[model samples]
Target: MLHTSLYCRSFPSPSHLRSLVLSSRLFPSVAVRTSPTLSLRRSRANRSIAMAATEDNRIKRIASSIRVIPDWPKPGVMFQDITTLLLDPLAFKDSIDLFVERYKDKGITVVAGVEARGFIFGPPIALAIGAKFVPMRKPNKLPGEVISEEYSLEYGTDVMEMHVGAVQSGDRVLVIDDLIATGGTLCAAIRLLERVGAEVVESACVIELPELKGRERLGDRPLFVLIKAKGV
Candidate 1:
C-alpha cells in the first residue's frame, strides 16, 4: 500500500556501519523509517484534526454551561457558578471525562480536595484517575490526627487540616479546587501534602481568577485552570 525510494550504494566498511548505528541511536525519533504514502499522511492529518475538534467542543460546552451570577455572596463580585453545569448530566459527564483524560496516566496515588465545594468534583476525579480521595477540611472538622496548615485569607486567617495517614510517603497527589481566588486554601493544602512526604503532581480548578495572582503564591508548580475570569 506504500512505496518508498530505497537507494542501494556500495557497501560501507565495518567502522562506517557502526557509526551509522550510533547515529540512529542518537536521533531515534528522527531516524524512524517513513514510507511514502499519500493515504497514510492523510489518515494522520485527519486523526489530528478530529482530536482537536473533540477538545474544542468539550471546552466550548463547559464554557457555555457555566452560568454567571452578577453578585453571588456580595455585590461587585461576579461569581462564576458551576451548579448549572452540574445539574445537566451531559455537561457533568463531559467535565469528568476531561479531568480523567488529563491525569489518568499521570501516576496519581491520591486526590486531595479542599473543604466544602471541592468535595463535589474530587471523588469522581479520583475514581477516574484510579486514585484515592482525601478531604482537606476546616480546623476540628477532621476526626483523626491531622496535619494542619495555617494561612491568611482575605476575610481573616484560617487553617485547613488533613488526616495524617491519608496519603503515604512519596505518593503522587493531585489537588483539586472549584475556584482559585487568592490561592490561600490551596497553598495550605500543598503545605500539608509536603509535610506528609507526599508529592503533589499538579493542581487543577474549573475556574481561575487570574487577576488575584493566585498562581504567584503557588510557586513553580503545574497549575491548570479550565477557564479564566475576565478581571478582578
Candidate 2:
C-alpha cells in the first residue's frame, strides 16, 4: 500500500482577487513587487539628490576660483576678477559646462555675448551647442552695418552694437555675460536682440550681485547664474 501526505493550499477570496485585478490595472508597473517598486523609486530619488549636490559643489568650486579685489578701480568698490578662473583649467571648464548643460536643450539658435567678458564665455558655449555666436560690441568695433542700443552709465550714456544680419526674426537667443552689476549692459543687449526681432530666451551670468537688483531690471525675461555673490 502507498500513502500520500494531504496538504492544504489557500487561494484568494473572490473580493481579494477582484481587488488585486483592480490594483494591477491601476498600477501595472508596480504590480510585480510593491517593495521593489518603492525601493527603485527611492534609488532614483537618491541619484537625483546626489546629482544636485554634485552640481552645487561644482558651482561652489567655480565661484571660489574668482578672486575679489578691493578698491582697485576705485575706493569703496569690490571687483570680482575672473582672470584667476581662466588660469585654472578645471574651473574654466566647469563654468562652460554649467552654461552648456543649461542651454543645450533650450532651442537657442544664437548666443549673443556682451562686449569683452561675454566673448570669453560665449564662444565655448556656442560651439558646444552648435549655435551661432554674435558679438555685442562697443561703437565702431564691428566693421559691418549694425544696430546700437544706448544705456546710461554712472555719469553718461554708452552704446552696444550688434551686426544687422547676425540675428534674424524668430531666432531664439541666449545673452551671456560674466557679471551683472548695474544691469545696464545686459538690458542693452536684450533691447538690441529684441529690436532685431529675435526672442531673448534668457540671460546668463557666472556671478550675480543680488544687491544690485540686476534681475529686477530684466523684467519678464529669465536669468540664470551659477553663483550669487554677497557683499559685492
RMSD of each: 10.3, 7.3
Top TM-score hit: 2
Query: How far does residue 156 in candidate 1 sit from its true spot (Å)?
Result: 1.0
Model 2: how far residue 175 lies from native, Å:
0.1
Q: Total clashing residue pairs per candidate? A: 0, 0
lDDT of 2 by residue, 33-76 (tens): 46978899999999999989989888888988999998878887
Give lDDT: candidate 1, residue 120.
Answer: 88
Off by over 4 Å in 2: 1-40
Q: Each prediction's Cα lDDT score?
A: 0.84, 0.88
Q: Estimated TM-score per prediction? A: 0.81, 0.83
lDDT of candidate 1 over 1-232, digit per residue (tens): 0111111123257675555556765534324355679769989999999988997898788888988888667887888888998988887787778888899999999999988878989999998878999999999988889888899988889999988899999999999998898888899899889998999999999889888889998999789888887433
